[model samples]
Target: MQKKVNLASAGISAEESQLFRESITGAKPIAQDKIPPVVAPRKLKRRTDVLAKALDDNLFYFSDEFEGYIAEGVSLSWTKSGDDPHLTGRLRRGEFQPQVILDLHGMTTREAKAELAGLLAYCAKQHINCACVVHGKGLGILAKKVPNWLIQHPNVRAFHTAPKTWGKHGALLLLLSVED
Candidate 1:
């Protein structure tokens, strides 16, 4: 019992009505005009627990027996045993530019350890070979501890106290072994 409607009465001209009909001549009727809903993919979360566990087990232990003595105003430099001896020299010469810099100013030993682990993890993930760590020269606490912590990490191939332009005694240029 639908009421009959006229195109002319609806204000459509005959030429326009004819053109519309011609345009849709081969079209089939749609049973449903509703669009389907889209579902977004889930994002993956990083496993900080595993990373923390590894850091705790490997990086936190600093042996008092192992003496890494550094006199005030002296630049620090070290290279892993069996690595190229020239690597330390190259680091000292400032051949490698730091891709990232970590400032550990005013951070406690615990906080610095956590931040250092995070930075190393990030550098490994990003395949960064060079990094600068600024531990400042206030009390020389971090200045001493930073080297000990770095020596523990296997990724650290070599490290040299930054050049005069780069923080000198207050910062270190690290050469990391990044897996390709």
Candidate 2:
């Protein structure tokens, strides 16, 4: 035999039913003419200065902004010491194939700096020796800045302009120091 379930025990009372009926009756039908018109959402304007400031906060930017500027269309190469005799030749001749490549063509200055730092850290963790950074030969902002950043990094041994077959002046070949 099944027991009967009492709905009143579920907390619903006659007062509640009366209140619900009153609420339903109180709500009058809204006329079509009285209805509010739908409005389109306003578009937000982005401030470039705010974005630039935010990017600057996290990136490893040069303290002296004037130092990273290079002449347009000029090729650049740098070696820390004279001991690495073959590094320049190898970088120029495209002998040392890059195990990792980072392209900074379309990135903003702040984004490129962060990316370059991340790339070096990644290469160091993985023991990657040969790396390449393609900064393009545009106005030379990246070409100039990338070299400066590379030179400052302790893990970077040497960097040179890529050969004609490997992006030439538009790219750089980096020799990373493997940490024990």
Candidate 3:
């Protein structure tokens, strides 16, 4: 008892009406043999603007946790994600012995920088546990620069003031990350 309805008279285009019929009744068995209609794809606008001010800003500045200062004479310690809780304590108690000693005493800043980078890379590769960097007690460039440089490196797990026998504030005990 359904009444006949003229969709075209109601303002639907022929193509729209055909689409509606296909939606309601599905495709006819004979029409399954025919190819689908060629529809032009909708044009999408590409996003050009970026939220980051610079590339480094996106990579390093994402952390909400304060990357605290590493002042001269103050012990610097940092544990990367998943390090054991007692590791820093063991380092503090002079338990993890320094496997390698790097003395930055008289070298120029440029020379010290290169040596530090090379030594750290070597330590990470060889899986060295502890290393001591002797930067001397005098208010020299190495005392300030060494701590700052170590803080920035990705492989440095933690560093602290060495025990009295190991040079006190003149040296720093470093815990290197072991490769998986």
Instruction: Report the number of the highest-TM-score candidate.
Output: 1
For model 1, residues 1-180, the per-residue Cα lDDT tens digits are 999779879999989988998999889977996878887988898899997787775555445345564544487888898898888688888899999999999899878878888889889989999999999999988888888878877899999989877798899999999999
Q: Which is the winner by TM-score between candidate 1 and candidate 2?
A: 1
TM-score of each: 0.65, 0.62, 0.56
Candidate 3, lDDT over the whole model: 0.73
Clashes of each: 0, 0, 0
Query: How big is the positional error of residue 90 in model 1, measured in Å on the Cα after superposition?
Result: 1.2
Model 1, stretches more than 4 Å misplaced? 1-73
Ranking by TM-score: 1, 2, 3
Model 1 root mean square deviation, Cα atoms: 11.4
Residue pairs that clash (backbone atoms under 3 angstroms), model 3: none
In candidate 1, residue 52 scores what lDDT?
A: 70
- Sorted by lDDT (best first), the order is 1, 2, 3
**Candidate 2 lDDT, tens digit per residue, 13-52?**
8788778788898688776787678999989889989866
- lDDT (10s digit) by residue, model 3, range 99-160: 89998888887667666776786787788978998988676568767766776777778887
Q: Positional deviation of 80 in candidate 1, in angstroms?
A: 0.5
